[model samples]
Every structure is written in structure tokens, then in C-alpha cells.
Target: MDCQVIFQPSGRRGTVKKGSSLLEAARKLGVDIESPCGGTNCCGKCKVKIDEGYVDELSAETHISHVSQLTENEKNMLQPQEIRENYRLACCTQIEGDILVFVPEESRSTQQVVLETGKDRVLRVNPAVRNYFVEMIPASLEDHRDDSERLKAALLDRYSHLDKELSIDYTVLLSLPVIVRKGKWSVTATLWKEQVVVALEPGLVEATYGVAVDVGTTTVAAYLCDLTTGKVLQQDSMMNPQIRYGEDVLSRITYGMDDDNGLAILHQTIIEGINTLVTRLSKAAGINVEQVAEMVLVFNTAMHHIALNINPCYVGRSPFAPAVRKSLDIKARDLGIRIAAGGNIHCLPVEAGFVGPDNVAVLIAEEPHKQEKRRLLIDIGTNGEIDFGNKQRLLSTSCATGPALEGAQIKFGMRAAPGAIEKVRLDPVSLEPQYKVIGEADWFQPSQTIKAKGICGSGIIDIIAEMFKSGIIDPTGKFNMQQTSRRIRRDANNKPEYVLAWSEETSIGSDITVTQGDVREIQLAKAALYTGAKILMKKWGTDQVDSVTLAGAFGSYINKESALVIGLFPDCNLDNVVAVGNAAGDGAKIALLDKDKRVEAQEVADFVQFVETAVEPDFQPQFVQAMYFPHGKDTFPHVQHILDTIPTVKRSKLEAL
Candidate 1:
């Protein structure tokens, strides 16, 4: 028997065999679901709601049976209230009959806010690929020269800078005779590095373009640029379709190591994603795909390996060695990229261990190596990349901060989107919260009828800081049980939580609250990040940095004060703390327009030293101390005055009571 299934919000419908898991149905129907554990049912991230009844598509009758009884694993993983609301783990639940399921925004992997634009700089327009229009004399009986030889001679005659031993792509050479004859011995040749002809056109084509891509774990962004003018023609971004396999690099690596076809699937998926971006960008810019002759890419080591179709199993193991550390120039056709047939794809050099070309890109964009004062650069994401350096030396490392800070592994958390709370401020006296949702221009008001869906990463940070400053929670991330307020109460599981939005103010028909578990998740995530920064500073033999730069999409939106309040990094002057949006993407764009910058990228990759924090003996203790609000022993000189204004209950006094 076959069961008809419909997933809401996306409205995707499909039929599957009876007793198939909901996760299997989602995969078959092309529905995006977060399964970071690779459908092992251990992560408990793939949650879906089942409607009580649905009308049968063929019989026109209401069917009540939808799913099998909840397994013992679901009973242990889900809260009591969630069970009552018909929430089931998609990996555990099996379809018994026709069903209508609703996947929550947090569970779905699409519609995320992807950051694409970055600070632009004046670039020296020396692109590796250039176009040259050459007019040659027709071949006569006396002048018996081969087509390839004649074309090379004519190119060197017109452009003295071109190499005398220029070569043509075999595919391009096959069509060269027909194209040159059709144009009456006049043609435009696209040469790569002024050495090899990658493409050819019938007439004098004046336009040339290239693409710069930033392949992130969660999102992929592409920039279409005019190689001649060094101007960005069009930009587009999309949620990385590979998220369906896993959310983090390690998970994907595990998937690859455990399954035979995992590496091939991941490689093909990213190629398809890039091809989709190329198609859209070319169409929007009114240019043919063949006209785009070059591409530059940047990503972390695991993503880099997956993009290049290399086995990443070793990248997740001890010592964490990458297959290659040097930059590569591969043919576009070899990678199945939908660009010019013989176009070249240039990948930036990668650093050792987990520090990859993306981190190197950050170094080039910020130029910390050129500054005299010590600088700390942090790119915050699921895996936080940290770099500390000055003119004398540079150090780099990666921290496994997990996905908690990005609204994962927390109750009532979601990505930045419409109806998601982005900012929050609580009153010190009443402990009442005022918030701003993503789609709204103003703070929440009583008369506005705003229905917040969930809290995003920035809002989660703000609320945690506000709770600490307002004395709602202690430094150890425990709810102040002695405080009396309507918003402060215990859940059905007897756990304390502070309500951010009442049931009437949310579309979920339930109150959104910050649970004790949520605070612990944030604490663990922040502690890992802070610990990594501390390790780098120790390696540099300094207690303070002259300046701090936050990079990435999430880092750009973080409130500096709130980040300090949570001890996301080591203490620094608030004035010196700056957020540079998408530095890695900026580095990719810079490399795309300038051929010299690509060489500089390789130099920077070799100059930086990678420190492995996992092997450090003091990591556990430092991580424990950093779990406290603003740290247990470290003094935050710049933000201490703000913390001093708030009154808090002493833990000893509460214990005595």
C-alpha cells in the first residue's frame, strides 16, 4: 500500500510506501529538513507536527490515522507539552496512512538570511583572463600554415605582450576553423594568463565577465563581475542545498566516511548549486554563460575538500591534515561547472588543519599582517575561525562552537527571518522584555498585533545579556527562583523558564520562553569561542589586543555590547571592536579582479601558523571558567561599569534562605 503525504509551508506532495519514515518521505519529495545526525534519530532535530485528520485524496473521506505510535526514543527526547501538541521526530515516525505534516521554520533548512555584500575596495584590474580581438590575413596557396599556428602568430603580432608559444584548448580548437571562416578571418579570443585560448567568438566581442563564489557550510553566495571594468554586474545567494545531508562539516564528513556514495553526492550537489547561481546571474546581467571565462572560490577546509571532490575523512581525524595546501587552477569542464567550456576555476590556498582558504581570505581582506598594532580577527559561524597577528607574526585556529549560537539546539530558536525576534531589551526593574522582529520597523507594541514566530540568534544573545544585566538570571545561567513575576515560571517538566512572548502574541499558539537548557547551550557555545581566542592570545604572549574585527554574516549583526556581556571573546575596548561584513567573500572578489592578489593569497597562507587547541592541556579548565557571565576570573575593564549598575542576588544569600 502507498500512503499520500503532504508537507506544509512548502506544500510539497508525494506518495511513499506504507510504514516509511517521515524523513524518508521528505527526502523523496525534495523537502529540506535539518538532519545534522544523518537520520540516526540521536540529534532529535527533525521534528514535524502531524494533523489529527486529513481528507483522503482518492476516496474523498476524512482519514484519522496518520502516523505510528511514538517510540521510546521520542518519549525521552520530546517534552510533555510537545507530545500533546502532536510533534513527532521525523526520523522516528512512520507513515501508517495518508497524512498532512507541518514542518516548523526551525526544522526547515531553507529561507535563511544569507549575507552577500561586503565592503568594496579599489582593485587593480589585472584579471588572469582577458579578451583580444585579432584580425588576420586570409590563407592563400603560398601561405600554407596550420590554423593554430596562424592564429598564434596573428595574436602575438597584434599584442606584443602575449606568449609566443600560446596554446588553444582542444575543444576550442575543434571549432576555431568554422568560427574564423564564418567571421571572415576576424575573431575574438579569450586567453587565460595571456598564454592559452580558452574560448572564441565569431565577431569582435567587447564584453568579458567572471564570477566570485563564497561556498559556506550553510549558505552559498556568488558575485558576477565585469573583468574589463572591475564592476559587480549582479549578485545572488541561496541556502546551500547540502544542508539536507548535514549541518556541519564534521557531520558531512561522517556521512561520507560511513556511506560509499556520500562524497560523490556532496560534490555533485555543490556543483549543481554553483551552476544554478551562474545561470541566474548570467540571465539577469543579459550575458551568455559562455562569456563568463573565470571563477574564484573560497571556503573552509572540509567544504574545500567537498567542493574539490576530495575525501575529507582525514580532515576530521587527529592532526587534521588537508590533502593539499597549495592553490589550484582546474578546468571548468573537469568539475562539471556550467561556465565557459575551457574556463579556469582558481581556488585560493588553504592553511593547515581546519584553518582553510576562507581564513586566508579574511587575512587578505583585513590586512592584519600589515598593521603594527596587534589585531584579533574572528569569523563567527557554526565553526568559529580565529586569527591573531601583527606585522611580526600571525596565529590562526578554529573552534568547534557548535550551531547553538546560530539558533540551533535551543528551544524556541530560529534563523533570522520575518516574524523572528531579532533584538530584545529588558527593564531592570520589572524584568519585562521589549523586542523587535525582523519584518517590523519598530519595537513590539500592544496595539501593533505583532505575532513573533521565534527568536533568532541576535535576539537570543540580547535576551541572555539583558537577563544577566536585569538580574533575571545569575552568572551561572540559573533562573533567579526567588524573583516574583508573571513571566517567570516553570514548564510542565518542572524546569524554570522566562517568557519572552505570551501565547496570544505568537502564531505558534504557545508561549515562547527561554529555558534553562537554552541558556546552557549558549554558555557552552560562547565558552568554546572565548576559549579559542584566549588560546590564540596566549600563543601570541599577550593579554590584550589593540583592535578586534568580527567577520561573517552573523558577526556583522551581533551587538558588540551584548557579545562582551556574554564573553564571546576576550575583553577589548568597545571603541576598537568593529564588524567587517563577509571578509572572506571580499577576499574572493579581490582575487577575482586582480591576478596579483591570488599570488598574495598563497603567501599569506604560508605565513600564518595554525595552533591546535584540541591538544592544549588547559583547554578544559579555561572553557569551564569562561562559561560564567563575562567570565569567572577575567576582568572586563571596558564593560564592567555597565555590569556594576545592575543589582544581583548573591548565590550565598539564596543558599542561606
Candidate 2:
């Protein structure tokens, strides 16, 4: 018998044999389903809910079935409690007669991070879009001039500063005649940058909006703001759909170069994400998509090329440069952005090498150029970008720091999701560990009480710092053997590993341990971060930073103590180091609201002296020194003392209980 399968929301349908699984039917329909486990039902990602047609339509005894009964693996994977909520693993469930399935957002691999607003910024209200109410004479038989010409004459006469030719868009022109007749020769025209008319209404188009977009390699975020009022109406974010092709910029470049139409594929993926954000933002703000009249985009150099559909193969090579170094203003429709067709999209200035408009945006948002003391801005991610200077001088560089800090390339590593261990600390003498997972409110005092999933970046940093401070790991990050802690053991590869969560205490049904290799990834990442900062410091001729601000999602979550103990950056006053939040996104918002800030961003970009780390002398030695704790010194004594003295609140609470 043939079973009819219908996918919800999209309304795509296909027919399959009764024994065929839902995933097989979805594949036949060419739907995008994330089967990262390759249909093994391991990832627990292919989840769906049955809405209709599951039971026999003609049943005398009220029989119900959607497919075969749940498999043993599926039962174990999804707890019995979740099945009652209409959840089923798509890879394991089969289609029985005819049924309809709903794929929620969580089931999709293109799941997005929650959209976060940048640091609070108060923007000036002067915008490029202006509204003018024009009154024109009715075309009479004596005045044989056409309606369009008469309207243009009135605009020029009433507003002396108007261009001689106040041309309206063809589409707007077609509607202008009817609009004037309806309003009795009075129509509101939305003027863009003095030359062209964007929108027209019988009365006034009171609400015009614009979007500020931050194009991250992992996620893309959009903020919808009122152009005139400078009020942000709505914001949303999603995982860059390009993630399925590759994880990092280097991998994406290789993918784009190796495959035919690879550039187009990557380009379309980001476009799809931006358009999706637009749709969601408009709906959330109770406005039409056409109301959004402008956009400001900021991204890294690689993402910059891919979004513009330009080939970025050269950016991956030496003496790296982008297709363009200056800011660009293009029509939103020209780039397939479904806002107002004639609306403009403004991109900030691109710095030399891998630094793109994002660094410019960072400078604009931070305003370090106007500050008194010397300051440093560090954006940590796949590619760590650092900017240092005072009002007089500015220096910048980019480091290829890979994605290890974001929870990839480690055993039991995962995103900062529910159940992931986000904070950890080990006792100095007893060598006992206490931790907190992402979802649970209370700490895991007993490892068996809370099931450990995996470790994220902050947890990894804390674990290593605590391990080093407590003498469980030596200064070089090697696991100390003299302690003879039960939690320490050798893996199959004969590497010393420290188990944070034992097999019975973890969701993965195995020990969640940090191996020697995991420690090395952190060392390499921190070394890159330190070396870049050192290069800028040497250029500034100062070993001490007046202040440091960590910018970005990962940077915001990292504990300052852990960062210092790991030697991720040079030492300064502990209170001076602060996480400023996503400054790049904030800069994009600034540029979107005020055109003058775009000029300021350009000035910041021009003033910066780009230092190429690869060619700089003393980089290798600094990098090698950076690999050790506190640059292989006996520094961080205060940090070690803090670890020995101040215990976790969880530990204290458990002790009191």
C-alpha cells in the first residue's frame, strides 16, 4: 500500500510505500532535513510531530498507528515522557497509512542562536529618508504640461534645494497620477538622499524602517529600527545556512573553490538567511516588509565576499586583500534583499587583510578614538581581531585562531545548549570537581545528580584554569601524576585525561574527560590571541594596557579569571578587563541610524595601521611563550590563591545541606 506524506508549513507532499521511513519520504521530496547522524537516530535532531491521519479512518475499535511501534533505540534516546508530547525521532519512525508531519524549528539543523542586541547605544535621529508633502496645480487644457512634469516643477519651486530633475521611480511614477487625484493634488513623497524619490502615499508614510545586519560565520542577526525615531522595533537571528557546507572561513573557501557553483551556493545560503530574518522581523514589528527602506551590513572579509556573491579565493592567500577596500552603497533589490526594491544597502569600510567592515563597525561602536587612555578591543571567534590605540594612534591585526574556543574539536564538545557543562572548578587539595550545566538552575554537587552532556568554551577554559591552579596540571598543562586522583586516567591513546563526569553521571553514557589533546587546542587558541595582542603592544611601545574590552558572544561568557589564568591575553589591572558585548553589531546599528557615523567608521578604518603578524619579527618566540601558562612564568599567584581560598557557591550550599 502507498502512504501519502505531507510536510507541514511548506505543504510539500510525496507518496511512499507503507514500510518506508519518514526520512526516506522527505529525501524523495528534496526537503532539507538535518540528519547529522546519517539516519542512525543518534543525534536526536530529526524530531517531528504527527498532527493528522495517524489512526485508521474506518476503525470499529478505535485503533491508532502512525507507523511501526517505536524502536528500542528511539525509546532509549527520547525519554518516554517526551513521546507523550507528540515527539518522534524522524529517522527511526516509519509511515503507516497516510499521515501529516510537522517539523518544528528545533528539529532543523539551520537552528539559529537567540538574537542578541549589541551594547546599548543612543543614536542621533537625522536619517537620509525624508518626507515632503508636495502640492501641484491640476493639469489644465491651457497648461498642456504632463502630470509628471507639473509635479516635478512644483517640487523644485517649493523646495529650492531640490535637484532640477526630481525623478521618481517608474513604479512610483505609475501610481503617482492616481494618488494625486485621490488626494486632490497633495501627495507625500519619500525622498532618498536628495536625488531620487522612494515611496509615495496619498497622505504620509509615517513609519519607515531600516535594518542593521551582522553577518557572522556561525550566525546572522538583523535589527529592525525606525529610521526617523532611531527606535529599534524588532530583532532576530539564525544560524547561517552556509554552516552545512563548512564550519570555518578556510573550510568554506576550499569548499567554494573545489565545487562547481560553490560560490553561488554559499551566496544563496546567506541571502536566504537574511530574507528569513526580514520576514520574521517585519511580522514581529507589525509592519510590512516594504516599510524597511535601508540596511547596513557588517561582516568578516570572507563573509563579505560570499554575501556579495564575489569570489574570495584570493583572500585566503598571502598579502590578503578584498575585492574592494572602501564602503559600498547598492540597491537592496540588486542583492536579492526583499525590502523596498529601490532601498539602499550600505556596507561599512573594509580594512586590509582579513579584517572587513566588522572591525570598522567595532571602532564606531566603541569610540576608542575619542577616549583619553589607551584601550584595546579584542573580538574572539574563529578569526580573532584585535584593535589597540588611543586618540592619537591606532593599530590593528587579525589572527587565524580556528573554532576550538567555540566548542568544536574536543571530545564531548557541544554548543552552549541545555545540559552542556558551562562552568567548572576543581578543589585544590581534594581534586574533587563541582560544575554547573547550562539548563539546570542548581549546581551539580554530585556528578551523578546531574547528567553531563558536553563542555562549551567557558567551561573548557574554567576547567583548564582550575586544573592548572590546583596543581592537577603542571605549568605546561600536562596532567600532574603525583596527585594520584581517581578522576585522572589514561585514554585509549595513552594520553593523561581528567574526568569531570563519569560514565554513570553523563547523558552520553561515557566519561566526559578533558584529554591532553583538548588542552593543546586551548593552548594554541590562546597563543594566537596573545601573540596578536603582543604585536599591537610592541607597536604601541607599552607592555601594560590601560584597559581591555572583550567583544563577541564567546568573549562575553568567558570568566575573566579563567582568561587570565590561561594567559589568553597580557596582564593588566583585573578590573580593567571587561566584556563589552557584541560591539560589531552595535556599530552596524549606529551606521544604520546616522549617515554621519558611516563617515566616522571610515575615518577609524583609515587611521588604523594594519600590522601583518606573519611578517612581524619576534612573533614565533612570543607565540611559543604564549603556549605556556602566564608565559611560562610563576605569575597568577593571586589567581592560584583565589582558587585555594574562594570555593564555589554550589560547594558551600552542599556543605551546609
* Best model per TM-score: 1
lDDT (Cα atoms) of all candidates against the true structure: 0.87, 0.78
Clashing pairs in 2: 112-239
Q: What's the lDDT for candidate 2?
A: 0.78
Q: What is the lDDT of candidate 1?
A: 0.87
- Candidate 1 Cα deviation (angstroms), residue 317: 1.3
All candidates: TM-score: 0.95, 0.81
lDDT of 1 by residue, 437-515 (tens): 8877899975665578788889999999999888888888888888878999998889999999998888667798999
In model 2, the worst 10-residue window by lDDT is 55-64
Q: After superposition, how far is residue 369 of candidate 1 from its true place, in Å?
A: 1.2
Candidate 2 stretches with Cα past 4 Å from truth are 1-115, 163-165, 178-184, 445-451, 633-657
After TM-score superposition, the amount by which residue 340's alpha carbon in candidate 1 deviates from its true location, in angstroms, is 0.4
Q: What tens-digit string does per-residue lDDT give for candidate 2 at 373-464?
A: 88988998878899998888899999978767876656556656666788998878888899888767888845344477778788999998
